[model samples]
Target: MPVTLEEAHELIARAHRRAGELGSHVTVAIVDEGGHLQALGRMDGAPPLSAQLATGKAASVALIRRDGAALRDMQQAWPALFGQLDQVAGRPILAGAGSLLIRRADTVLGAIAVSGGQPQHDDECAEAGLRGLE
Candidate 1:
């Protein structure tokens, strides 16, 4: 099943909770398997660009079917190819620490992303968000 609206909101809430514990502000974005946005949330202290960044991260993960960490590896290994990736996503495909593929069993349901904190903090928040699905 695709990620439901309720699930998206829950994911955002869970991410926010993790961010709070980390003493960080963040923006969370959830996207469907087709790279369509489902829901987004940005904390007051988060960077203004965080909304767009979070969305791009999530959408890119969905489109590429890879977690953000792995994508970052690919980007580092092939900067020339990754440079042309924006045109493919119709937006910047940020391969940052906080984006991850949302899966069910072996099925890819969508993706989730968090931004506005240190890479490790953002990654932790994303992991917390995924727990909402469980």
Candidate 2:
């Protein structure tokens, strides 16, 4: 089942809090099973580029059903396959602070992406939000 709007809002709120705690500003994105955006949050100080990056990362994770970074590594290992992946409508996964896959056991529910801060900070914020869902 897809994540509800309320759930998405809570997750993004948690992410915002986490980013604040870490002294970072971030952009958070939630994408549904079809890789369509469900919600987005860009902290006041977050960079403008974070919006698109977060959206792309979330879409990539939802579409691939895996961590965006892992997919990016796979793409690097197989240029031909991954090269074409970038053109596959949400294939080339973006890295940095934004990009996470949301799953329940073996079932992938959706994805979340966070950008605008350091990579580790972004990752931690994303993780913190996901943890709230549990």
Candidate 3:
């Protein structure tokens, strides 16, 4: 089944909880395998642009079926190609930390990303969100 609202919210909550534990505010964005937004949650003190950053990160991972770290590496390896990706994608494609794919068996369920914190902190929050899935 595709990711439901409840599942998306749960992911946001867990990611937020982890962010709090790390003493950071963050925005969490969940997107379906098709790179469509499912749900989003931004903490009280999160920066406004964090919402956009999280969404782009999540979409990048969902669309490519690759984690953010790998995408970041590719982005670094091919700056010119990644630089022009926004035009090709018709949306910002941010290849950064804090993004991950949600999977069941060999199938992808969706993707999640966290922003408004250090890259490592965001990565941790995203991992925490995944751990909460049933």
**On residues 30-89, what C-alpha lDDT tens digit does candidate 1 reach at each position?**
999988999999987999989998999999999999999999998999999999988877
Model 3 CA deviation exceeding 4 Å by range: none
TM-score of each: 0.95, 0.90, 0.94
- lDDT string, candidate 3, 30-132, tens digits: 9999889999999999999999999999998998889999888888899999888778878888888899999977889889999999999999999999995
Query: Which rank order by TM-score, best down to worst?
Result: 1, 3, 2
Off by over 4 Å in 1: none
What's the TM for model 3? 0.94
Clashing pairs in 2: 98-114
Please give the TM-score that candidate 1 achieves against the real structure. 0.95
Q: How many backbone clashes does candidate 1 have?
A: 0
What is the Cα-based lDDT of residue 65 in candidate 2?
A: 74
> How far does residue 42 in candidate 2 sit from its true spot (Å)?
0.8
Q: Where does candidate 3 have its weakest 10-residue lDDT segment?
A: 85-94
For model 2, residues 1-134, the per-residue Cα lDDT tens digits are 87889999998999999999999999999999878899999999999999999988898878877786787677678867766766876355554445788777777779999989998898899998898685
Clashes of 3: 0
Q: What are the Cα lDDT values of the candidates? A: 0.92, 0.84, 0.92
